[model samples]
Target: MTANNATPPAPPVPSDAVGEGLKAAFRFHPAGVAIITATTDRGPSGLTASSVSSVAIDPAAIMFSVTRATGSAGAILDADSFIVHLIDGEHAELAQNFAVSGAERFTEAQGWTMRETGEPYLPAARVALRCQTLHTVTVGSSVVVIAQVLEVIEGTRGEPVVYLDRAFHSVATA
Candidate 1:
């Protein structure tokens, strides 16, 4: 290894095959919806994310990926802190607002607050997690962030907001 700690070269791949494999290889299970928000000097920003998951419970960590081009990513890079709000069915409008990229989101939200670290939180979320950036890895156009959960707020009882088959679902049995 070099003193500079540069990564070793990777072997060459055949044309287009690896790309196609990547497109079809990974089929993930259904996941719940969450909003990852960060506070930056410019302002608070966030995205409607369906990728939130617990990586470990013992160490209290979770992982989510954000497109490098996502507005929230730019804020996260600056603030180095964030929060993940697990949405409930009551937040359908909230999810829609967050999913809409660009422009102001927090301006219209009623129960949102910016934490000291510049992360955004919602009083209505089923679960709100304050996070410290533990690790970040680049994968193509996205950055995978694994955060150490610092603070956890458990909400009053409610149904979970879920996403499956490209549709929104609630955990409350009908």
Candidate 2:
């Protein structure tokens, strides 16, 4: 068929079906859970996330997606920096706290603190990555935030918290 050079024809599908079919076709993949935190003028706020991932290494960039309306969103935006706490296997409570909605999320523990900018992060996590926001992109109902690593705190190397198929899994150590 001869093709027009002006524009490409759009593929056709039921509008609402896109969202529904997407959830089914999405094969659940296991991912480590983390609590990303940043300080807000209202106090501190954060949320539990399993979508955090490493994006680049030369500039030490990482990416994580959070819901657009999440309380943590405003705080992270306000501070312009954050700390990603890769929780160890023993931190189910902390995970639950950050996963739930409330004002007490910031005060759940005594040791969570920022490195240089006073952003909140769990001191006892398997790894604590302090990052400054570099870019943001909107996808679906969330925002993909790309951050530049500022510093890192290495703690007890243990089984990190993993989420798979809507449940928690433990990482095996060799």
Candidate 3:
């Protein structure tokens, strides 16, 4: 059979199917959970993200994506800076509080304090990074935010929270 005369092309994958497939593929890949917090005129807001990654070392930059519809997205996009709190196994509840919409994130109950630019930093996090927003790019359904690290606070040493297989897991030290 000739090139064009061979078999017919396969049908395009459905968007929902593609989304489900992507989710399944990522479920096995463990990722560190973090809460990206920013100050809004209304108050403090934040969201949990497993996509945070270090981008550069010289300037100490990190990147993470946030859905446009998230309550904290507006504040994060508009603010000059924000805080990235690396959640640990002990603080998974804190991560869940921010993961969902309309949760009281920065109240006294959560035990947080304001950072340099008014961003909330969790005192119980394994590591807290204060970063200044450097660049933001809209990709697909999320905005990719790049920030420069302004300061870092080392919290209680422990196993960092890892999300895998639709659940949170922490590895024990040997």
Per-model lDDT? 0.76, 0.77, 0.84
lDDT of 2 by residue, 7-75 (tens): 877768558888777665543677788888887778778888888899899899899887788667767
Lowest-scoring 10 consecutive residues by lDDT in candidate 3?
A: 1-10
Most lDDT-accurate candidate: 3
lDDT score, candidate 3, position 132: 88
Ranking of models by TM-score = 3, 2, 1
lDDT tens string, model 3, 39-90?
8787887888999999999899999988898668888888777889888888
How much is the lDDT of residue 122 in candidate 1? 82
Comparing candidate 2 with candidate 3, which one achieves the higher TM-score? 3
RMSD of each: 4.4, 4.3, 6.1
Give residue 102's error in model 3 in angstroms.
3.8
Residue pair clashes in candidate 2: none
Global CA lDDT computed for model 3: 0.84
Q: How well does candidate 2 score on lDDT at residue 74?
A: 65
lDDT of 3 at 138: 84
